[model samples]
Target chain A: MSDTFNFFEYYTHISQEDILLSYKGPLTDVLLSEFSRDIRAKLQEDRRTGKKVFAIFMEMAQNVLYYSKEINHFGNNDKVGTLVILNTETHYKIVTGNLVFKSSIPLLIEKCEIVNSLDRDALREYKRKLRSAPSEHESKGAGIGLVQAALTSDNPLEVKIKELQGDYAFFVLGVSVEK
Target chain B: MENLEIQGESGVYFIPTVKLRADTGVCEISGESYLEDTSEFYNAITNWLEQYIREIKKPLTFNFRLTYFNTSSSRSILDVLRVLKKFQEQGGKLTVNWYYPEDDESIAEEAEDYMKDTGLAINMFSFEPEE
Candidate 1:
């Protein structure tokens, strides 16, 4: 089978969703800032929703930045991931996808389940516990970013994991922020 | 050590304004911080705080008025806060205040979360945004 992804098909779907922006490739601090500023510019009317959308965007964006299996060997060496933001009549959707090692999938799924299961107060408590706990010296994060993303999102975590060739899998997370 | 002052810059990535004054023991990190290198930029600030606390031996006040910061930068912020909290536990006079626009509760929630983590009182200040 051809390994080509159909850009036309993907963009057609994007256009239908009224996506404000969609990007595929490496996610750097610079690119993240650009997306952030764009979100602010587009959603200037609602400061609260803008902030929440931005917050959720940042957290989810970082997950792609840190966890993606495919590395960007170019400017600002880092992993590459796909990121998309949609503006609908009632809500904003921020979606990010990246390749991850197969070994990490179970943990990611478990974390998502827990976040999806909790209420706002329990989520806050979970965040507190994670934040206060002593961290391993080399731990990427306490996964507080995910917690913050879930809290900022309008709905529970929406995740899809697909197995890729070898020891890698594609992970996509979609978060919604209602206006 | 002499005071450290860095003019904040905004672009694809923002560097927050950093001013550390040893004489009056006042340090302020304001504006936005989403850096090309989070650790390299923040280590200088944390190192200065460490030195000042050890040698200067004066009351320190930190005023943070950051409008935006990315999650990676937030880690460095927590590192700085942890240093301050440690100093406070060791009988160092320390005061931390975080300022945000009254309209944005996102920053406020983040500040409160920082306080919750460090077990330190972070005074909140609200201000009007310029048109």
Candidate 2:
């Protein structure tokens, strides 16, 4: 049996939400800067919160760009991911999802839990300590991006990990900035 | 020695504007820094600072007016600060001024963190963005 995808139904569902922008494709530095410009424009109404939202967006998008398991045969052979921004009356939400190795899920969840459990001062101290340590190039920023995202949003990370076929899993990270 | 100057670009990736002068002894790095090659980008600047301290030994001033920088850039920044701290330790005159948007406390706080990390005195200056 085959399940046919319905574009119209998906569009209807998306339009019903408060999504400001959404994209599912290769996460390249070029595309990241383009999305950065778009996010800056969309968040122009509030300058202060816009900075926080923009900072969080960069961190989360770059996370997908670096760690996603799915590689796209596009410019620079970049990774693929999904990014969405939603606007609410009081906050702006940034969400990113990408495929990763299922083996990394437990570590990712542990990292999120540690970040969520920290207070503002603790998070700052953690980031400082990480920054001082020598980073391995393979770690791709050494998880400081996640800590930076938490610090900028001043909110706990909303993470969801779903096991996929074979050794792959989908990792979704969401952060909110009060406007 | 020849000076180093790079025009920062914000296209595919952000490159912080850099101007390191051996003649005037005034170096300035302004604009956002979220480069694809963070280490390669900042290493050249750090090397230049080291050379200036070795050869010039004059009163050097560094002005940082970055509005945004990522975590990797933050590490590179600490490297730069370390260089300044070294110069200060060796009896070389140095002044490091960090300028940020008057409304952005995070940038100011980041400079403060650099100060704490490097044990270098970084003067903080906040400026208003023209509307």
Clashes of 1: 0
- List the pairs of residues colliding in candidate 1: none
Q: For residues B31-107, what per-residue lDDT tens digits would candidate 1 score against the true structure? A: 88878788899999999998988898799999999887766677788889999998999899999999997887767
Indicate the residue-level lDDT of B44 in model 1. Answer: 93
For residues A1-179, write the lDDT of model 1, one tens digit per residue: 57698989976897885788899987777788888889888888988788788878877887787778889888667889999898889898999999988998898899889988999878877876766655545355637778778877747889999998899999999999887
Candidate 1 chain A TM-score vs. reference chain A: 0.89
- For model 2 chain A, give the 10-residue run with minimal summed lDDT: A134-143
Each prediction's interface RMSD? 2.5, 1.0
Q: What DockQ values do the models have?
A: 0.45, 0.80
Candidate 1, DockQ score (0 to 1): 0.45
User: lDDT per residue, candidate 2, B65-130, as tens digits?
Assistant: 998898889999999999999999999899999999987898998987887788888899998854
